[model samples]
Target: MGKMAAAVGSAATLAAEPGEDAFRKLFRFYRQSRPGTADLGGVIDFSAAHTARGAGPGAPKVVRSQLSVCSVSESDALRAGLQPVSTWRAYGLEGYPGFIFIPNPFLPGYQWHWVKQCLKFYPQKPNVCNLDKHMAREENQDVWEQSKALLRCKEVTKRRPRSLLEKLRWVTLGYHYNWDSKKYSADHYTPFPSDLAFLSEQVAAACGFQGFQAEAGILNYYRLDSTLGIHVDRSELDLSKPLLSFSFGQSAIFLLGGLRRDEAPTAMFMHSGDIMVMSGSSRLLNHAVPRVLPSAQEGNLPLCLGTPLPAALPRDTVVEPCSVEDQQLCASYLKTARVNMTVRQVVATDQDFPVEAAEESERDITKEGICHLEDKITHGKRVRLDPDS
Candidate 1:
């Protein structure tokens, strides 16, 4: 029989028997149906046809199977429904990537309400010194030098503390609240504490996590002309653990790219309350923020300050931090600084290894035994040994 006719015949047979051999015959039919493709392509087409089979008497029916497959395909497999599978190049990243849009996951109107409420708490800007401005001050050079000198003197020890877990929790919470007021530092997981303990338990329940650790929140602020150098957050982190980052602020273009730092990067417009988790071999990938385009603001949406957002804020106004009427006064002065909190788990220090303690215990036993033998020799006396020893 001709290839096409054979395919049709096998498909009919598979419909009747529904066994492995019949399934293979149906797959071969589809493989021969494709015109002018490579042999491997034909094989793949056959496999796809077999895999895409509709349900049968003993299996799920075609309609139900199609719906289930389509649902998973919609939620996790595609990005914006415009790109084809395996063609990461079409997404501008040239690497397999996925994006999820959680529409108002922070509770509808919560962002706007939070801005209005926070304004009430600190009606007038606090008198606290701005770290970035302070760092740029001419007279502060001496202080900066002195601080750097002090940091030089400090030992950079990677010792595991008992309260490492507590530190992780505190840092995560601090990042959530934009590091408001109270001083909190990141902690590694060694001596697990309150925050670390909670995070570890939560992560453990989530499944598939190899290891976990937390670092103190690092606060970054950008002004109108400020630009962050293009760089990836790859140093000092385990390649095995995926990094989870949460952002709050005026939006910015988050550029993600391939493994090499020089490769062209794909831009993702990340906004307030967006959570980005990167892992599965993409952990060490090169990514960065090239610039914050001022022209991308949302006009009708609310602003964090009591002034209207200027026309220059780049991306669309997917999120409004405050009401339209209130933010019209001081929005321009807000500087669009975004706070990002990155959560991760670092490997424990070498000193924390159980093997080191065991080795030390063995040495102590040998030393004590030698001391007893010396004592017997010095006294020149016979000593009875107990079998129980």
Candidate 2:
């Protein structure tokens, strides 16, 4: 069979199966490491022209999406380290509404800034991370600083003790998420980073969402072998607002599933600097990062992410240039890692958090261990909690 035909056959098998969770089946298929048996032909590569199986016979599933270029000023876009709004290549899937995918719209050398922030800035104190649950406050104060010297060492050995940065699994910003309750509590709020909020607003505005408030942020740090389990993001009180996700470092296979578990999902590649805005009908759909692919070259990842400062700085650019030392440390760390930051607006503009109920509401079906699920077959996979649980 031809490549396209084979892809369809593989996907069809999942849909063809009776009484099985198609989304889960596909998730397991992509995460499994059976070298010769695994077929990636079914995966959609948005960076390239690829056919989406269920779109139609011989039709590409990705459709050109229009952005509100006029909504964002050129000055604002530059400040956010993004290319002009007019230059962004946005697309929508055939079957998915309110989902927007922009392939690496970052200006040259700009991604370095975001990468540095995720590693060096966001993990600092005042922000909460998975390690905080078990570690003392003083011990986990500076994740990047504590691990910088060790990570910068050239001779990497398996036996070397892992740095604190390496041990980091996830970091929460703004309104910190509660794993047990699966809700954003009013009392658990922190000052959201202004830089990230600005960036999120610009991107959201360009995507046609005016006044999009970025109230919460989750940064998931993934190693090459890492896999994120299937789950939905419904913790936010305002389901109408879009959830913005930004990717850096190595690429990963993203599976966007339907509302029902039995409904099969469409797989796509999310490369560095890529951004996903899930809103409208697509806002609460199930999704997962089944696998993180190794970079084609350890030295240069995502290809578009060049040197720290590839060109002369624009006057008053918001994204500061990375220092030589910081660049080296970030680059070295990224050679084996990927960072994903998802910004969310938890509450509507007019809405206020109601009194904390005596019992947690069971509206969101988040799988337990969403950020820390361990795959039986793999070492660092984390499962998301289901709302029903």
Candidate 3:
């Protein structure tokens, strides 16, 4: 028997109670910190799918997906830092009908551009981030500029306090998401980045989802131990639209569950430059990141991250090389972190949020005299972690 099958069979031996959530038990099993407690044998690694054919986790039957090679032009694909459509390798699991996974389809050195953008550009003003809860507007602006020096020198001053960039937990672009309300409102909106929108549209077109609009985005920054809770992304007004997720820096274990929260989930590894699209029936599936692989736990960065870019690129290329200073900052931050950007369409073309209903909901909350609380309640006392943590 394969290790994945054996590990999963052992988990089933626990004989969960009638009402117990099987998914949570497995999540906790993988999240365990004690040495020899967590078993990674069951985690699927698509990078090795070619060689580990029948031996990997779940031995998932990987099938090649037909891409609309004609949907995108050669010039356009190159500008987006993507290889020719005919050369791209897209896959779909046997049971996952509408699910698609493209393992690192990016051209050599192209992933760095996106990584730099995530670290330096996206967290700036006009974009909403976790740190905005208590920080002043001026103070929160220019996160990259303020934290660059500290992060660049992080290696030398190993004991220095954490930088603002390190403190960033999440960032929302375009139509910002409300964590407490678990909804997106018309009033709470911002212009999505054009570069990201173009990239999303190109990938969608290649995957047979023509004219997909890039509307809302949620960028999650994770450390080695930080975990995202199990949740379904059904807040979007339009359930018909597909969701695009892009991963960079380090590797992570992604748990994809079924419609019911109690259902046991399938685990997979999401490495840098990997792209996943959950569409059709899989659009609203429950998913979470149980753990981020400790690539930097012992101070080693993944070899894929060190790829060098060519000397020059086409003038029309959407992505280009970043400055040496900025590159240094990104390298320093990525040493112990992972960044994931999920771009999704919130509303259809003819669809507009019911402003009256949202206003009424707010009025009702005010009438009840209930105050919204922030997720972090330090009460003026700060929580600190080791410099590496």
Of 2 and 3, the candidate ranking higher by TM-score: 2
Residue range with the least summed lDDT across 10 consecutive positions in model 3: 365-374
Q: Which tens-of-lDDT digit does each residue in 168-232 have in candidate 3? A: 87778887666556666456568898888988988999999898999988888776656776777
Q: Quote model 2's TM-score.
A: 0.89
TM-score, model 3 to reference: 0.87
Report the lDDT of model 1 for residue 178. Answer: 18
Error of 3 at 346 (Å): 1.0
lDDT tens digits by residue: candidate 2, 1-389: 47556655766686559877988888877776232333666666667754323242333377888999999998999999898999998889877999999999998788998999999999997887877766788998999889987897764566676688977778888876777777765565678988899999999999999999988998988877677777888878899999999999988888898898888888777899999999999997989887888766554566776656555677777687788889889888888778899999988899877666213433221222345333222344443322211
Assess every candidate by TM-score.
0.37, 0.89, 0.87
